[model samples]
Target: MNQTAPATLRSRLWWPSAAALTIAAAALGATLLLPRLFSDPVGVDPYVLRLTGVAIALAFVALVWSRFATVRPILLAVAAMTAAFSVFAGGPQWIENISGSRFDFNTQVLFASAAEALLTAVVAVLAVRTSPSTLRPLLRLRRFGPTALIATIVGVAVFVAVVMLLPATLLGREGIAPVALARDLPLQGPASVLQSFAQELQFRGLILGALDRVAPPWAANLGQAAFFGLAHIAVVYQGPGAAFVPVTIVLGFVLGWVTQRTGSLWPAIVIHAVADIAVTVGVIPGLYGY
Candidate 1:
C-alpha cells in the first residue's frame, strides 16, 4: 500500500493538470484585453501592450496556482512567449534606435537571440524531464513565501531610498538629468513597480525557475547568466564604447549568479531595477548627454 500511494497520487493529479491548462488558456486570452484598453491612452505607447500582457499572464498564473498547480508550466510558456515577443518588438529596435544605426538583424543581437532561445529551451526540457511530479517542474519552489515577499518589499524600499538619496557618483554616474526622456525614464513610481515585477517574473521566475529543476545548480546558474548577457546586448550598443559590451555581459553573469545564490529574485530584481533607474535617470544627461 505504501509503495502504491505515490503512484496513486500521481494519477489523481492528472485531472487537475487538465483543468489548469484550460485555465491558463482562458487567462491568456483575457490578456488581449490589455492592448485594446491601452491602444490610445495618454502618453502610452503601443509597445507597452507587451508588458501588460506579461503582467496579466502572471496574475492569472498566481490566481490558479493553488487550485491548479499545472498552471505553473503553462505560465512559463507564457513568459517565454512574452520574452520572445519583447525581443522581436523592442530588443532589436532599441539597439537600432540607440545606436543611431539602421535596422539590421545581421549583428550580435541575432546570435544572442538564438543562443538565449536554445539555452532556455534546453533548460525547460531538462526541468520537465527530471521532475517526478507534474507541477514540480514549475511550482515546486522552496517555500519562503513570507520571507521572500518581505525581502522583495524591503529591497524595493532600499532601492528607492538609494535612488533618491545616494549621490549619483556612487552609482558610477553624475546626476539626475537623463530622466528628461520620459518615454524611457518614465517618472512614475507605480510604473516602476510594475516594470520591476514584469522583469522578475520573466527572467528569474520563469527562466531561472525552469533551469532550477533540470540542470544541476551550477550549470543552471551559468546558463541563465549567459541568457542575461544576451538580453542586454542592446545596452552595450548604446554608444561608441564597443569595449563596454563585454562589461555589460559580465555584469549580467554576476546578476544571474546572485539570483542563483539567493534562490530568490528579490536581490537581482532590486539591484537591476536600481541600476536601470540610475542609468536612465541619473546619468545620460548628467554624463553621457541625451
Candidate 2:
C-alpha cells in the first residue's frame, strides 16, 4: 500500500511544529556554535566552515527523514542558507582578486551583496526545473501587499527612532565628520540596502517560509530568527561583534513576527537596510569592514 503521510502531521500544527523548534536550535548549534567556540587563532577556513555547516544540516535531514518529517524542510532551509552565506562571505575575495583590489570597501561590499542575491535567485530558479515546488515555498519573493506597505512605513519610523535613541557610548563617536560621511553615502547606502535585502530573503523568506510550512507560526518564527541571529557571528570581528549577535537574534525575531503578521518580507528588508546604513555611518570601523 502506498500509504501517504499521516493526517496527524497535517491536521494539527502544534506538536510537530513545537518539536521542530528544538531541532532547529540543535541545528543552529551544530552549524555555528563550533565556529564561535574556535573564533580565535584557530581560524577555520570559510570554505570549510560553509561546507561543514551544510553537510551537517543535510546529514541531519537524512537522519530524520524517516522519523521526523516535520523538520525536513527546516533542515533544508538551513542548508540553503549556509550555502548562500558561504557564497556571500567568499564572494568579495574573488571580486577583489579579479579586479586587482582596486575597489574601495563600499564598492567591494556592493559587489559581494549583489552576487549573493543574484546567485541565490538564479540557482533557485534553475532548481525549479527538477522540482517545480522547490523554489516557491522556499522563497517568498512575491508577497508585497497593502499591509506590507504599511509595515514599510512603520519600519522607516522605527529606524528614525532607533537612531535617535542610540547612545553615543554605543557608537563611540565623539564628533561627526560631515564631509567623510557624505562621501561614503553614495556607495555605502546602496551596499547596505542590497546586503539587507539579500539577508532578509535568506532568513525571513527562504528559511522562515520553509519552516512555516512544517511548523506552527511561532515555531517557524523562532527557527528562522535563531538562524538569522547566529548567521551574524562574523560581525564579532566587524563591530562590537560578540554583543551584536544577541541583538541580531532579537532583530530577526521581530522581523519574522512582522512577516508572520503582514505576509511579506519587505518590511523586514526595509528596516534592516536602514539599520545597516545607520550602523555603518554611525559606528567606527574595526578590523573587519562593517
Question: Considering every candidate listed, which one attains the maximal TM-score?
Answer: 2
Tens-digit lDDT string for candidate 2 (1-290): 21122345444644554455456556555544466666633335654364547545563663456664444444444555556666667767777888986987668877877876776565445332232242134455677999999988987898688768878666544455688788888987997788787778767876676556545678778877876775566423233456677788888899899888887888898998988887777764521333
In model 2, what lDDT does residue 163 have? 61
Residue 127 alpha-carbon offset, candidate 1, angstroms: 12
Indicate the worst ten consecutive residues by lDDT in candidate 2.
127-136
lDDT of each: 0.49, 0.64
TM-score, per-candidate, Cα-based: 0.44, 0.77
The superposed Cα distance between candidate 2 and the true structure at residue 129, in angstroms, equals 6.7
